[model samples]
Target: METDFQTVEQAKSNIQALLKGIVGTRTVAIRDALDQVLAADVLSPIHVPAHDNSAMDGYAFNGAAINPAGMTQLALVGTAYAGRKYEGTVKSGECIRIMTGAVMPEGCDTVVVQENVTVQGDQIHFAPGAVKAGDNRRLKGEDLTQGKPALRAGRILRPADLGLLASLGIPEIQVMRKLRVAFFSTGDELRSLGQVLDEGCVYDSNRYTLYGMLTRLRFVDLIDMGVVHDSPESLEAAMNNAADQADVIITSGGVSVGEADFTKDVMQKLGSVNFWKIAMRPGRPMAFGHITNPNTGNAAFLFGLPGNPVAVMVTFYAFVRDALFKLAGANPTAVPLVKAQLASNVRKRPGRTEFQRVRLERQGSTTVAHLTGAQGSGILRSMSESDGIMVLAHDLGDLQAGSEVEVLPFEGLI
Candidate 1:
């Protein structure tokens, strides 16, 4: 295992290079495929707006009958409603009243809105320059053409995607199988909830936080393995058990350079693992590799995170979230960062990226980030009280008040 320090970007790139989406796909109805990854490209089977129809409630007439500079008049033959078509051909000096989405009558390619025409018994009068040729007619295949790709493979189906599929008359689609993820926390000083609070032992908060984070990703089947004691035998048994059932395994703590942290030894013995000291604050010590179950030959991707509460969340968002999406056959998108001005000056070192918790407030038209209390890796409440985590880049130092910064909001991320 390599213990050299790596930049955050380098770490991310390395992790991405070593992983691929899990295999296997199954057909599912569109109704049950929300947030699921598409296994194949969805092609349009038929043209949208199958027939030429009216775009507005108006009179449909041939474009040749339109008077460019003077008043044009035509006899109103009949009225057409949506989902119905005027059967008879529209001859010269004749038109038909058509509602929105109604199929245009034969030889009628334009529509003069009802508000733009005057009714005089059976004759409809159009004012000068009222409408142009094909002004309000919807052509067939205008929205989507048949035999064309509607949604590509590796797309995460959303509500809008479902509607688009329904519009194409698709009842079912193929989607990648749900990714299985098993996670747990490791530390002798950590205690489960409802247990006696002994001296020098604190309640484990990382598992709960990990649960919340993993649950947000609807495509993942979460397996919470609870807390494991920091022993080589315990760590190996847990890793073997998790790898047999899950595609990915996550552990917080026991990967750091401490005597009590036996995770590094256990992981290296089981498989080829890399221990990394990433160049980022709140989360620095991390391990990435695959743990194999020797008996079953089943291996799972592993993420060994730091022990701190805030560090677990930060590292998971920065690294694990996208990796999970990728392994689940999804085209993962990075969380967007918005520009905001700082409320006060902050001190920082020059080579490490820092994620500082801050509350956002609107100052006139500008958004300002107010620093939260004591930005520490162990302070979990710092994340709770803040609206976002301002990312101070690696090269920045001693930012002055009112300086601009990039912030990842907690609204969608947390």
Candidate 2:
């Protein structure tokens, strides 16, 4: 099959088209639910502040043209602490003592900050020319109006979102469930963890890398479907077992056109398969498909990542991870990428996309990114020690120092 590898923008569009509203909808609690995309529009059931209040500890007075600078004597009403509102009206030349978050009295229009006013036995002294109208008042529903959209669909809730929801007294929210994912590795040269390595057997680093990456995504279930050797029957059995329970299956290695590889043949027999060699160095031979579990008649998407540590990581981040978000009912939203100054030079191939691991450091109030030395595909240490991928354009072969480049934080879209 002729597989014209999709460009980044084209790939994003394709993923969007394939996964529009794929998660459907579900509900969850607000506690510890940050980054879970909102499934529905959040309508403000009530006003945000619920009432007009003081934003700072201050003195509330009418200030109805009574010069506060020259005013010497004023009656001191009872103090209004936070969560307590003084219900009485403020007459001329009279002020109410109000604390931060306290509701402002009905007749008061201006607030004199506590620093600008002095209290002496039922009398308050205001500094010269200090009366400011609406200085410290938090207007009712200033943040949001009744029936207003507090939050929109497809938004990944953050700390502020949680705080706003809590302020609205919404203890729970509707969110799509996490993506259920299953992954495995196939190779005769691979060995599981804690097992003594025999000659020619390398520890399967791809499995752990995929596991960690999936863990960072906070998926509903990151199931390890176990190791499958270079056998068609074993590969088929693993696929059938995983597809029955998992929404998506992720396999590392063995998608290339090799005689020992059984992933492609099994994918064809079980379900439709689409294989492609991405135009990216260290991650070129990545593949994607769908698989049908024979026993349960359930089908799920399958991803075959390259064997190299760097290739698998980059491909997982770009391709497989996006697919998992779609399966989890997320908005298929693109993760944010920021531009930062480059501290050192970076060189790459002109035709292939490169994701260089970099460490962003603060140097004299400016953040600069420097490439980690080892660029080999087998180096897992680089990915662990660095911040995130510094994506280089396909046509650009070299990035000079002091040039601004995209910096993807490790914490993004987690």
Best model number under lDDT = 1
Q: Kindly list the per-residue Cα lDDT of model 1 for residues 282-360, writing each as its tens digit.
A: 8988999988989889999999999999999889988999899899999966778978998999998878888899999
Q: Per-residue alpha-carbon lDDT of model 2 for 1-414, expressed as tens digits?
A: 125765554554565465433455667789867888788899999997888888888788776645655754568876777876576777887888888888878787777888877789888887557756677788999989989999997677889999999988899998876667889988888889888899999998888888888887754578887678888898888999999887888888887666464567787889877777667767777666678987789878878888888888888887767777666666656778967899988777676677888888888877888887798877889888898888888777787899889877777847
> Candidate 2: where is the Cα deviation over 4 Å?
1-5, 20-27, 66-74, 259-261, 332-334
**TM-score per model over all chains:** 0.96, 0.89
Q: Which ten residues in a row are the worst by lDDT in model 2? A: 15-24
Error of 2 at 337 (Å): 3.1
Candidate 1 residues lying further than 4 Å off, grouped into runs, are 1-4, 259-261
| Model 1 pairs whose backbones collide | none
Best by TM-score: 1
